[model samples]
Target: MTIIRSLSEVSDNYRALFVDLWGCVHDGVRPIPGAVEALRAYRKTGGRVILVTNSPRPRAGVAKQIAGFGVTEDAYDDIATSGDSARVAMFRGAVGNKVWHLGPDHDAGFFEVPAILTDPAVIERVPLEQAEGIVCTGPFDPLADPSVMRPQFLAAKTRGLKLLCANPDIVVDRGETREWCAGALAQLYTEMGGESLYFGKPHPPIYDLARRRLGAIEDIGDSSILAIGDGPLTDAAGAMGEDLDLLFISGGLGAEETGTAIGGDPDPEKLDRYLAETGVVPTYTIGTLR
Candidate 1:
């Protein structure tokens, strides 16, 4: 893999780009340096940029949060969020209406389809058997250990409740810390013999949504699309699975494993081994989006 400094070096090759949000554009707390500018620059040059995020929030909600981090709407042509995909599944009767929400209040918007029981007190009052299924947005607290929810998970599992994971990200960079996400919980539940459905990167639904959004802006084929992100397991794997080229950011989630600090040159040997283990070979590698 070749490491470059910015997307501008190879932006001309793709008509539509699927850009990851959390680790690629920002670290959850602030915008990554030049990340927003790089996307805006790509758009200015006639590229259709789709902010494909594993965030559990709906597209509007994620857009609002990213704007708080200085990411302007003009930075991308559109957004496709896991929550939006999950909402589509819910609308299609994939999951029942009486759902047990297993995340924070900020993510309760995912349950806006009807009466959402967000109150912890009220939720505790209702028996686990009463809920038809579970909708997990994320952990109760991003900073806390995921094991704290094991009891609830077991209870739901015992009741044979299916889980719909909105965000399939196991972990994400939160400023200087690594925080657990809903995918971790969903994986744990599945390990304990619970059936779970995931809607995000590394899954087909979210990518399908992103491709449709990009198609609306430009009639580009998969070969003319590039997926850019920091996580190899999510972004790289997703792009490779969808048969699209990938632009892997070396300094984000795989920094420690690849021995590439943020804004630093990636250790080629380590990066190669890491990609080999994940079975994802990116078409391009950059220290950062810019």
Candidate 2:
């Protein structure tokens, strides 16, 4: 893979860029250094930047969260989130009406529509057998161990309830700590023979929504649309699945296994082996967004 030191090295080739938010642009608490500037620079060159994220919150909520991290409005053209996609699916009756929410209060807005039944407290009190499906926006408490939700997941699995994972991210960096996400729970449910539907990265629905949004802003082709992100499972896999080129940020998630120290070059042997094992190779690898 080509190793890029900066985004400017290859920004000119793509017309529309789908940039991952949390790991690439920020660390959930603060903005990553030079990330916002790199996006601003790309936009100045007439490239359309879409902040594509696996955040379980709606696009507006994600935008608000990022803004607090110092990512200005001009950095990107628009935002698309998995929560928005899940809302669409729920509204269209694709995920059913009676739903049990498995996330915290911050993501409650994802089920605010009239068509879906998602009273957090009520759902928790009611038996899993009564709910049609489960909507997991994120872990009930990101700081808690994933095993904390194992009993509930097991209960839901026994009932044969479908799980709709709004965010397909397994984990995210909260400051310097790693926190589990909804994807981890959904994965556990799938392993236990329960059915699950993911709304975010490595899935087609979110990418389809992003493509339509980009198409409306510019006449772009698959080859000219670049996906920039930090996760091999989510970003790289999603880009390859969608037939889009990728600029993988090596210093983010999976950095330890790749032997890539934050803000440093990746170990070629380790990176190659990891890519081979995952079967998700990026067009290029960069140490950071800049």
Candidate 3:
């Protein structure tokens, strides 16, 4: 219930941070103001910052993309992406051998097996009719509605194929534009009688991956860690479910609901109501990372 202006107010309370990338570090197109600096300052204080993102790209790919936004390596210690988490599941045959990819061509990296897995299943991307399961990295067109995949979802439902959702985010803000994500398609598929599996935020798989990534560097416990993000459902819910303290960013996706203008604090009453309605209680609140 406490609202603060910058991350520095509580960065000393935790040994590490599980930070969301899209709305927290960058607005998809570029890094948000003061975000990169806040992370750098945290690192300078010997606090590790892990970019735990719902991005449906491998960690390396995400690094390359973030570099374009000026989110340099000095800002954070490591990254745990939804794509890498879900890719491990795919290579382990969580879906099946012949799977249909319900996403754009840019997500072809999702099929690449990780080098760490000793023996991985042979996965092939085939037509929906010839598939045993489905893998959704994202929608073919993010700006379009999710209902457009009803026809394909119906066919997949008839065959009883399991859909592995890489990114469990419904939408993300790219500059001033909001775009749909893989979670939208997975939600539609489940609603239309198809089974869908999630590996991102609010789910245990990605969190496990994040812990493993953190363990590689230092032996930290959950009590000493904090989660920071902008999304109410994904970030807030995930942090709460993991029993970790969360620093909610009101100026990102929840800006309109919380009456938070850019680079400004949110209306207390509006922020409280939004959290109550969404059922997510964070340890702290901030306008932005700084």
Candidate 4:
């Protein structure tokens, strides 16, 4: 794959971009250096930017959160979130009317009814014993190991409760610390024979929503759009699945594996080996967004 220093080298080719949020634009706590400029510069060239994220928040919530990180409105056109996608399913009774929440209180927005569903099912958060299914936004404690939920998952499995996973990210590096996400819990539940439904990256529903959002702006085809992100499994897999070209940022989640140094490019040999091991071959590679 080609390794370049800035997104400008190839930004002219695509009419739009499907950009990942966490690792590509920011490190969770703050904005990454030059990421904002890169996005704004692309927008100046008339490229529509869709912040397609695996964040388990509605588009409005994501916008508010990113704005606090210095990502202004000028950087992108629209957003499509995994939370928005999964919420539609929830309102449609993908799990059931009564669901047991597995995440913390911050993610209670997952239970909100979407505006698109006029006749939405009335959802209620009940105890595990009274729950008809499960709505998992993330772990109750992200730092804790996912194995702690094995007993609960076994119980849910026994009762045949389906788990609707909002975020499919296994982990994200918040500044310098890594934290587990909902995907870990969903994976554990599935391993214990409990059905788990995913709505985030590497899944089709979020992409479908992203495309529809982009289509609302202009008629941009898959080949004319570039997908930029840091997740090898989620971003790369999602791009490959949709037959879209990818600009893989090795400095995010796979920084150590790809031997990418801070504010520098990845080690070519190590990046190659890592890509080969992961079985993800992107159209391009870069260390940082700019």
Candidate 5:
């Protein structure tokens, strides 16, 4: 792959960028070195930057967390979270509809419509027939019995209820540890013949929303936008599916340890070996975008 010593090479080629949050711009706790400056430089050159994250929280909440990390509101044009997209789908399809949630209560914010909220304690008391659709945001209790979840999925399927998945990722970084996500639960429900719609990375709608958010400030072409991320299944897949330039960050999903490369430029044989194993040939490779 092409080793870019500076961001200037791609600067003129793109008018806007949809930057990833966790590994690209910041760790869970803080911004990476030159991340703010790189974005500032891009903006100074008239490039619009949109921070796109797989955060399950609402966009407003995501922005607040970013601000807490010392990233000022002026650093980027707009921010979009997976929670926002899931909320969009819920409002469109399940308005005034009752929802049976299999995830945490924090995810309740996504269904803040006031009509869909149901207590887990009351799930056994309430008939499954009363629920509208199955919304899996994530596991309420990570250590909770997976077998206990089967009945919920089966009940939803038997009733022809819709399923909405907030985060498409099966796992995500929590501090230095990786934890399971709503997608894993969604996958289980899918195997049970339950119809489910997902929101987040590797989905076109979130990318489209991110594009629109960026477009408000400056023009961006599909060819000029670059997707920098660490997940082969979601971030990388999404970028490739959209046919955009991509720079894959290693070690996010253990791809650095196990993954193959695809079609890309000159790089070390070791890198080629890693890329070959991962099947995610990035335009560039780095330990971290910082």
Candidate 6:
């Protein structure tokens, strides 16, 4: 694989790109430096770039949130979130089946299939045996205590209902706050002997969705399309599975321990150690695009 620096370094080969939203372009609150410029430049070159995110919100909802961060819809060709993919998957498989909504209310919009929002009061009376599957977006602030959530998973485990995780992200740092994602809940549920299906990134469905959305007008081959993000498990893994080039940003997912962008005294060594341990080698590793 080719290791490089700067977004400009990747200007030549790629004709299309699938950029991640949360970490690569923005941090859920604001846009990252050079991200907008890089995307604009890529578009200027007649390249197709699509923004894909694991946010547990529908495409329209996510578009509104992105607009809130000053990211206009014109920045990329299209946007696809895990929530949209999950709902599509759910609707494709079973229609009108009841689902146990297990995430934030904002994500509840994904499940239009007779979903029962996991309200605190309702949990007392409602049995997991009643639902067809559990649609999980992320941790519930009211039920994030684990003690309460575990019981729900336990109930689902006994019934053999699916736990479809809308967002497969394990954790995400919203500005200064780091919180768990649906993947974390799914991990716990899986440990409790429940089946979980991830909807975004690393999964083929979302990748195919992103590719279709990007348009790929230039007919770019595998090496000419890049997947850029900060997370190894999601972005890099997605690129690997899709046979696309990857640009892994270190500064977004984890805080800069060495106080550097790409690598410095401690950061470079730490990155090396992480790559060694995970065995997920990326085409490029940088601190930030700027």
- Tens digits of per-residue lDDT for model 1 on 1-290? 77777788888988888999988899888888889889989889988999999998888899999999888899988999999888677655565666777888888677554222232222221335678888788988888888887898889889888888999999998899898999999999999889999879989999998988888888889989989988777888888889888999888988888888766768889988888887768888987778
lDDT tens per residue, model 5, 148-259: 6797788788878777888887776655666677877878878889887877888888898788777776776888787778777788888888888886766455433633
| Reference-based lDDT, residue 20, model 2 | 96
Q: Which ten residues in a row have the lowest lDDT in candidate 3?
A: 107-116
lDDT of each: 0.84, 0.83, 0.93, 0.94, 0.70, 0.73
- After superposition, which runs of candidate 2 have C-alpha atoms over 4 Å from their true positions? 114-129
For residues 63-96, could you state the per-residue lDDT of candidate 6 as single tens digits? Answer: 8898899787667877878877777766655312
User: Which of the predicted structures, 1 or 5, would earn the higher lDDT when compared with the native?
Assistant: 1
- Model 3 C-alpha lDDT per residue in residues 102-213, reported as the tens digit of each score: 8999888888889889999999999999999999999999999999999989988998899999999999999999999999999998999889999999898899999999
Backbone clash count, each prediction separately: 1, 0, 1, 0, 11, 1
Candidate number with the higher lDDT (3 or 5): 3
TM-score for each candidate, following the candidate numbering: 0.92, 0.92, 0.99, 0.99, 0.82, 0.87
Q: Which residue runs does candidate 5 get wrong by more than 4 Å?
A: 5-9, 94-96, 113-129, 142-148, 255-270
Instruction: Report RMSD (Å) for each prediction in the order shown.
Output: 4.1, 3.4, 0.7, 0.7, 5.5, 5.2
Q: List the residue pairs that clash in candidate 2.
A: none
The weakest ten consecutive residues by lDDT in model 4 span 107-116
- Model 1 residue 195 CA deviation (Å) reads 0.4
Task: Give candidate 4's error at residue 204 in angstroms.
Answer: 0.7
Q: Order the candidates by lDDT, highest first — what do you get?
A: 4, 3, 1, 2, 6, 5
Q: Model 1, which residues run further than 4 Å from truth?
A: 114-127
